[model samples]
Target: MLDPKTGLPPRFLRTPDAARFLGISIRTLEKHRTYGTGPTYRKIGGRIVYTLDDLQGWTENGVRRSTSDETPCRVFPARPLTPAEKATL
Candidate 1:
């Protein structure tokens, strides 16, 4: 479990350690890391490292509102605001 009290990154885990800790196959973790879809990690030299905290964070439990109450999200590129919107400044 992630020790929030410490807030320090958990001891780093090798691919096998991380896989065993999370009860998954190392190949699965490897696949996600390659595509950037899984828990955060660090790459040292040629090795991948996972933190206990990242594993714990993946399992945190907070309820999201139902789809009926969900708001559609709008994504924008990182750039200066449009002239019309900037006029308020």
Candidate 2:
């Protein structure tokens, strides 16, 4: 469907589409959701959906110039954070 504001496809994407857009497997996306480590999503009428902007923003969190770069924001794995990791956040 086209978005009234942008005259393009709607920004919202379902799980599989969102995962493909991010180049990750659907199972990985599900894992991220289960662990609460993925992009921000909306629950609309019992469905979970991600916005294109949110997907891009989440990927941007992992951007780095070098291995030693220290960015405050990061895109973590699709799993629970350890105590030490939680402390850093």
Candidate 3:
């Protein structure tokens, strides 16, 4: 359940919130829910619900590690180097 006093979204998230937390599209989430391939969830009073810990575990398992620190993106010069520019080398 969500904690209003803590300013946290929820320990138990609905479908949409859970999908967003997992960095997956809602359709994919639904597919997972249908297939029972994803993390643990509950059908509370006929509505699906997920826990924060379950989502965190799912993220840890399937996440793609970021290489940002090792290699960062950069923009190149807009203009192409001409033959004259090459000659300078």
Candidate 4:
């Protein structure tokens, strides 16, 4: 449902809804959170929430024009980064 003030979806979404928005399973999204590889989120009243803008920005990091095209940033898998990969970031 749209927020009355913004005429858009609510400013923040909880974990399950955010996963649905991104077309990924909730578990995957949780793993991303655990590994620090997911969209930015907020912890309010002890609940985690994600903003639409932050989700979009994280997805955009994976955008590419071609298979070989380089990206300015990357979206990593929901796992710990190797030391080499960490170095690059």
The root-mean-square deviation over C-alpha atoms between each candidate and the true structure, in angstroms, is 10.4, 3.3, 14.2, 2.7
**Of models 1 and 4, which has the larger lDDT?**
4
lDDT agreement with native, every candidate: 0.64, 0.90, 0.68, 0.90
Best-to-worst order by TM-score is: 4, 2, 3, 1
Q: Model 3, stretches more than 4 Å misplaced?
A: 1-9, 63-89
Cα TM-score per model: 0.54, 0.82, 0.59, 0.83
Between candidates 3 and 4, which one is better according to lDDT?
Answer: 4
lDDT of 3 by residue, 24-72 (tens): 7777788776655676789899999999898788655534456433322
- Candidate 4 structure quality by residue, lDDT tens digits, 21-78: 9999999999999988899999999999999999999999999889988765777678
Model 4 per-residue lDDT at 29: 94
Residue 40 error, candidate 2, Å = 0.4
Q: In model 1, what lDDT does residue 1 have?
A: 52
Q: Looking at candidate 1, what is the lDDT of residue 85?
A: 44
Clashing pairs in 2: none
**Which stretches in model 2 have alpha-carbon errors above 4 Å?**
1-7, 87-89
Clashing pairs in 3: none
Question: Of 2 and 3, which scores higher on lDDT?
Answer: 2
> Model 2 over residues 1-89: C-alpha lDDT tens digits?
57688899976999999999999999999998999889999999999999999999999989998998987776777899899987977
